[model samples]
Every structure is written in C-alpha cells, then in structure tokens.
Target: MTKDVIQTIKDRASVRAYKPKEVPEETLEKILEAAHLAPSAGNIQPWEFFVVKNQAKIEKLTEIAYGQEWMTQAPVVVVICTNPDLSAAKYGQRGEELYALQDTSAAIENMLLAAEGYDLGSCWVGAFDEQQVKEVLELPAELVPLAFVTIGYPEGDKEEVRPQKELDEVTTIIN
Candidate 1:
C-alpha cells in the first residue's frame, strides 16, 4: 500500500461527537462513491444506501440505536442495507447468509476511510433494532439493514486509544 493509504488507515477512528454543520451534497456523494467502489462477492452488488438528512428521522434512529444521542448530531446517516435475495441469486445459501453481509461490511469500511480523507468524522454503528430500522426507513423486505455510518465535522479532540493486542499476537504466518 502507498504511504498515504497506510497513514489514512492508521488515523481513522470512530467518531461519535459531531458539529451541527451540514455535510455538502457533493461531499456526501463522494463518500457514497467510495462505498460503491467496494468489492462484492461474484461481482454481485447487493447493497443499498439511505442517506438520512432529516432531524426527526435521525432522532428516531438515536432512540432505535439504544439512545446513542450522538447519532442525532450528525448531518448525515448513511444506512447500508443488503439484499440477501440478490446475492443468493447466484451463490445460494452461503450468499444469503454470509456474502451479503460481508460485502456490506467492505462498503462500510470504504465509507469510513473516504470520510477521513475529506477531514470529516465518521462512526460505524451496528447496535440497533434491525426490524425497527427497516420500519423507520420504510425499506423493502428484500433489503436488510446492515449498518449505519454517521458523518459530520467533529466537535473536539478524540483521545488516542491503544490497540488491544500487539500485531504479532494477532498475526500468523505459514511462509
């Protein structure tokens, strides 16, 4: 990887606090473009993104997400949903059960990195009632809510957090 790419990865942190300023339409589109570039299994892209800009919906999402009030402060909440049926059209059970979610995860990571590149803060949120998210977003049954990415300018400094384990402890090499 390029040094800049490595630096970007190292600098990324999940930001929960944000400024009240709105994210510009062009910037948000760029982040979404990054997500669209993420790899998919068998080239089957099964993800759908819902860019939530409404305050009331964001507040409802905060309630649905166990009252993580920080979510309400974000200017944009990108709801990444996956369609298992779309994935399963080719890979069957494995596609439905695993690949769809796996692909969505890759997309989420891309979104985080892209936000970081633009000097915007981002947080990936998974703790929410899935059913409630679907109802609140008025999603089709085929689309299952996978994750939420909140985006905005950060309010203040984020304390650096040490990795739980050393790199050697987490890696295994056979070569």
Candidate 2:
C-alpha cells in the first residue's frame, strides 16, 4: 500500500508495547534503507546501523535503559551509532562534535517514519548508559551509540497523543 508522507508524519508516535511477532527481513531492509537515505553533512555519512535480535543482548540493553521492561519485549532493536572520527576526517572539531550527531539523529527520524509507513511499531530510545551499552553491543571505542529504534508489530491500539504546540509558538519568520 502507498503511504502519504504527511499522514505518516502525523501518525508517527512512540510505540512502547509490541506483539511477539518478528519484523520481516524485507521490511527491516526498507526501514534501514530510509535511514541510509537521510541527509548528512557534506554527504559524509558518519553513521552505523546495528540490528540486534538476540534476546540476551536485548535484555542487557533493557537493563542499560534503566530496566525498561518493555524494551525487552520487542522483536528487534536497531542501534543508531555515529563515528565522530569519520566526521572529523574532513570537518575537524565541529564535525566531530556536531555534524555526526545531527546526521545520526536525522537517520533515526527516518527509521521511525519508515516504520510507521510499514504499519510496524517503533520507539526511539535515547536514555541508556554509554559504557554499558558499548559493552553489551561490543562496540569499538570510536563508534558511539546515539539512539535505538525498537521494532515490532503493535500489540494493541495507541493512545491519543496530546496536541502539538501551535506552529507560531515554535516557528519564526525572519523575512
């Protein structure tokens, strides 16, 4: 089924509860593809996407996420990592500190939107102990895990999200 972009964005919301069903390989690939297509500074994509399906590892990650039990139930978790040194390769300090993070964040949003389009449920998890996550994921020193997108089929209906702030309150026209 074709998806409407605006509707997808409007429908996007954090999905915490999930069914036991696993995400199909093709669907996961499409979600990753959307993330891969996200914009990067100077076209230097300094991000790495790690797909974690092992239950033991997911449990460890849940512990790192402050024992959020819901995380452990998801069928898969896609960790969005960033390589600062890769950004530093061309843009130096600013790139390392800022651009790399920005690039990965964009990719994370793409993953969420893509999941919504596929009628899959997802949640972007950002709160986690860095060192612990690295240990569990066996990440190298330079690769930083910025966020996680937990994916699975929704177990039930999502609650109505609070209305967003008015556009004027959050935006400004300089001209």
Candidate 3:
C-alpha cells in the first residue's frame, strides 16, 4: 500500500553529505513552517530555530559538533532549541527540562518530514556541545539546544537503507 506520506517517510534518509548548492528561500520557509506546526505539550510549543545559512557560521557549528564535516557542507543548518522558561511558569524544573526537549524534538521531526516531501535530504544531529553551540549561535541563556538539522539537495545516491529487523525479532503481540 504505497501512499505519499508513507513513501516520503520511507525515502527519508540521514544524508551525511551534500552538493554545494543553496536551498531556495521559498523551500526553506516551507520547511520552517513544518517545524512551527509541530505539536507541543499543552500546545505551548516551546521550540525556537536558528536557521544558519552563513558558511562561516556553519563551519563553526561543524567544529562545535566535533568534526561532523557534513554539517558544514549542507546549505543550511537549523538549530532547534527550547526555552525551558516557557514551561517553568506552569511546571517545575523537571517539566521545563523534559517538556521543552520533547517539544523541540517533535519540531525537528516535522522539519525532517517536510524536507523529505520536497525531495531534500536532512539529518537530525543530536550530539553536540550545548554550551559551545550556544556560543556559536549566540542563543539566549534560557534556551536549551535540542538538535541540529543539516538540509540540502542530495549530492549522490544515498547510502542503502539498513535492513529492518523482522517482526518476530522486535515485535510482540499481546493476546
């Protein structure tokens, strides 16, 4: 049963390399909109994105990401962050930490799906130095970085999709 959404999801791959071409403004805007529309806890939607297209800035982020060179090649890197303070007024520190992180993750996924829909490649990068990234992006103190997404047109054929585990290997049926 092939469907547009399913096909997009299946086609999505974690692209580790990219061509040296800029993504158009309209396409970037649509991808950002997808991130904005993602659902959040209690509809609070605490995600904030820093769209970095400047080559120098991307290079710096790539350094901060500990030699993830592909980050620098991509046309744009969307840094998805969260403001815990937005959640703090209602819940405590735990709520601020957990919910804000969750909110940002959801937003990143939306952006990824949107990129896939546009036949663009994207990779959700979760490993990075929070403090260094904040310094690189000049983010506010209250905002916690969740993930960095590198997006652009594919440079070449994507690496093959890893084989999925069989249902018997991972799934369980509760009778």
Task: Find the candidate with the highest TM-score and give its number.
Answer: 2
Q: Residues 1-175, candidate 3, lDDT per residue (tens digit)?
A: 2229888888888998899999999999999998999887778889898999999998988888888987888999999989988877767786687887788788898899899898889999988899999887788999888899999988889888888888798888899
Model 1's alpha-carbon lDDT is: 0.91
Candidate 2 local Cα displacement, residue 103, angstroms: 0.5
How do the residues 84-114 of candidate 1 rate in per-residue lDDT, one tens digit apiece?
Answer: 9988999999999999999989999999999
Q: Could you tell which candidate, 1 or 2, scores higher by lDDT?
A: 2
Ranking by lDDT: 2, 1, 3
> What TM-score would you give candidate 1 relative to the actual structure?
0.95
lDDT agreement with native, every candidate = 0.91, 0.93, 0.88
The stretch of ten residues in a row with the least summed lDDT in candidate 1 is 1-10
Identify the superior model by lDDT, candidate 1 or candidate 3.
Answer: 1
Best candidate, lDDT-wise?
2
Deviation of model 3 at 112, angstroms: 0.5
Candidate 2: lDDT of 110? 94
Shift in Å, residue 24, candidate 3: 0.8
